[model samples]
Target chain A: MTVIDVRNLRKEYGPHVAVDDVSFSVEHGEIFGILGPNGAGKTTTVECVEGLRRADAGTLEVLGLDPHADGKRLRRRIGIQLQESQIPERLKVWEALDLHSSFYDTPTDWGRLLDDWGLAAKRDTPFAKLSGGQKQRLFIMLALVGSPELVVLDELTTGLDPQARRDTWELIERVRAGGVTVLLVTHFMEEAERLCDRVMVIDAGRVVAVDSPSGLISRAVPEQRVRFRPSAPLDERLLTGLPEVTRVSMTGTRVEVSGNGDLLHAVTSVLARHRIVAADLRVDQPSLDDAFVALTASRPHGSGGSPGASEGASDHRRG
Target chain B: MTALTKYELKLFLRDPAATLIVLVLPVGIVALFGVVMSPGGGDAIETFFPSAAIALGLGQLGMNLLPSTMAGYREKGILRRMAGTPVHPAALLGAQLVVGALFALVSMALVVAVGVVAFGFGPPGSIPAFLLTFVLGVMSLFAVGLLVASIAPSGRVATGIGVAVFFVSIVFGGVFMPVESLPAFIADVGDFTPLGAFMRALRASWAGAWPEPLHLGVMAVVALGFSLLSAKMFRWE
Candidate 1:
């Protein structure tokens, strides 16, 4: 079942069109990702879908309910944790959990959440006293407190240390294992590449590309890179002459051979005959960030719609 | 609804800044007035006590009460946090108003008890008129307080604005001065403001002094209007 369906959604904040004619769908229980650069309309699009922002024009259905007309009801069925919303500075860790848990009708066990989020030790500490990783864990625990079928997480791991980031990733996998659909709004290419089943790269408020991570990388920049440290010297003429070699360009010890079919064997045959034995060889594949840069480089800058004004804007009351 | 009310009360009571602004400051304002002026104008304790209570209530409800309550909630993001909850935002407003009323009543009692015991203050000719003043005073001040909170972007801003308004209303509204003692223009302005009418009606009812009903009615109307507007314009985030 498609839990969320957004068709030709457009959200304009004055001059800049934040989300421009964007369309996408999220299947039930799928870990879908909306990926883009800093100013991409990924957050805006998700906010519109979550019923936080009313699109200038669009039709949105979340969990088979209209986001705008039935916003309150839909919100009750889902869990949302905003990017910058840390619990109040004075609120104790357990107090924060208890307060948030009270907002839902059938809440997850408070004690269970404490243990699950690894916040049991810090239960008595106030929010201001918490470390960055501790605070992030508390937020994640709060987000899952209601046990909703669909969870909307906006930039879940923006500023965590490496170890904390990995722990968060594991927690996300755990949440997915429980059968909850996740709508992740993020700019981290590694996160999208690692966790997202299928990715949507939005640029200038429009869908530029959508597919699995490997699929996107391959589709955008196909072929493996041939790199090797020359044991002696390489004969460029014979290597370039191979039928599978589409392009060959090199400087110093590094050499890039791009082409199709049996290139390893074909290049090896040429090197062996020429008495060039290459050491320290590596076959490189493009990462999600590389594909991300390739995809959004063409988009206009500041497409996220007033990144500066967004901080002070009072319009956050809706979405 | 209960959760919102409880949360508001918890936050209102827990916030160190709000605790001082709403609970301590108003009581301090009242204590200052009691120390500065001698109670009773020779008629009886009834004559002077009610007027003192009115002055103290205004200090509690109007000047100190409204601004800090609203501003504090806005500043703490308590209002914003409550907005997203299953609890209705209306209940949150109601909770603040109730809390203001709660603290105002306690302050009024404390001020009155201290006045009667220390300054030989007494009640008014009619117990009913005095009770009316208390009821009207609480409502009027709560409305004005809501208005202040509605307008302020943060608690600190609200506190600054609230304190300024409180002193102005107290000095010009005749809470500290007799109407005849004020310049005519100042007295006229006082009649229109809720604080002015509250003090006038309260003094008159207590000292066997009587002012036009129009003053009381006008303040009541302003309070009602402000209460509605505050609830309407309030923002959570």
Candidate 2:
């Protein structure tokens, strides 16, 4: 079932456009991500879906109900953790959980939730007293207390240490494993690559691409690389002559090859045939981080309306 | 709603400013005046000091404490966070009102107790009328506070406006001088203000008479008008 369907979504802040004709649909049980840079309107788009902001144009439906028109009904079934929302500083962790529980009709047992989120011992600690990671863990617990079918988490791992971020990623996976569809809005490429089933890359209020992590990487930067130091001096034409190799360069007795489709197999076979054994060979495929940079940075700034302009430019470059 | 109210009450009690304003200040005001100002204490000290204490407490809670709490919640995004839930954002305001009114009543009771124990002041002659007047008085002042909360953009601004209103309300309520001592025209205008109307009704009940209809009507109208306007003005963000 499509839990959320947003078509031609448009929102603007006065003269400046925030979300421009954005559209996407999320199926049940998929950890969908809206990956974008700062001021990319990722938050605005989700706020419209959460019914926190009214969309200026377009059709949005969540759980088969209009978000703005049926906000009360939608709020009951969906949980939202806003980007920078906060509870009272003096409010204790347990009290915050208990108070949020009162807002839902059938809240999960808060005691168990505390233990699961590693916040049981800190339950009596005030919000001001908790560390940043502990506070984020509590926020997640509050988001899940109602056992919502769909949970929207925005920038949940923004300011955490490496280990803490990894732990939060695991927790998010656990949330998805519990049969809940997750909508995550984040700028972290590695986080999206690890958690998202598919991602919609939004840049400057426009959809750049929508695909799985690997799909986006392949679509953006298809050239895979192979680098090695030659055991003996070899001719560069040996690599450049191959059909799979698009570009080859050499420096200081080391050679590098970049091409599309099975470049590793092609280069290794050629090296084997030429009796030039390669040492310290390394293969590199573009990461989502690389793809994200290419996807967003490739656009000529402020040219969103004419979609084919950038596409044509890239085509010219490829040709 | 009960759970929210309980938590809000806990927060109120735990706050040092709320404790000082709602619990300690009123009692201190009554004691200060009863001992120092009314050395040759008589019916006037017994009646006027306790009434003034109630007015002072209401002014502090309604204009200062209530608005500050509401604006603080909004400033810190507490209301916005709660807006995502099935619970209405107004629930926080409602809980705040409940807790503030509760503390006002407690403060009034303590002032009355101090008046009796410390200065041999007499109790209100009409119990039922006193209770009615107290509830009405609380409603009127809290409504004004809610209006301030709804309009102030931040906690600091709210506190500033609240204090400004507090001084203005108390001056007209005859905390500095008896209403009888004020010029007739000023007293007439004072009857329409929350603290002024409250004082008139409280005095009447203390003197063993039902409050004048005009004073009661002023409270009703101000309470209704301010509450409706503030409710409309309040923004979750």
The deviation in Å at residue A76 for candidate 2 is 1.8
Best by DockQ: 2
* Candidate 1 residue-wise lDDT, A68-123, digit = tens: 77877877778876656554567687877787777788888989878876789898
Q: Give DockQ for candidates 1 onward, in order.
A: 0.27, 0.71
Considering the true interface contacts (CA pairs under 8 Å between chains A and B), give the fraction that model 2 also has.
0.76
Candidate 1 off by > 4 Å: A241-244, A259-275, A280-284, A301-319, B24-83, B117-119, B176-180, B208-212
Could you give the CAPRI-style class of model 1? acceptable
Q: Which segments of model 2 are wrong by more than 4 Å?
A: A251-254, A277-284, A300-319, B37-42, B176-192, B209-217
Q: What is the fnat value (0 to 1) for candidate 1?
A: 0.12
lDDT of 2 at B90: 90
lDDT of 2: 0.86
Model 2 residue B4 CA deviation in Å: 1.1
Give the clashing residue pairs of candidate 2, or none.
none
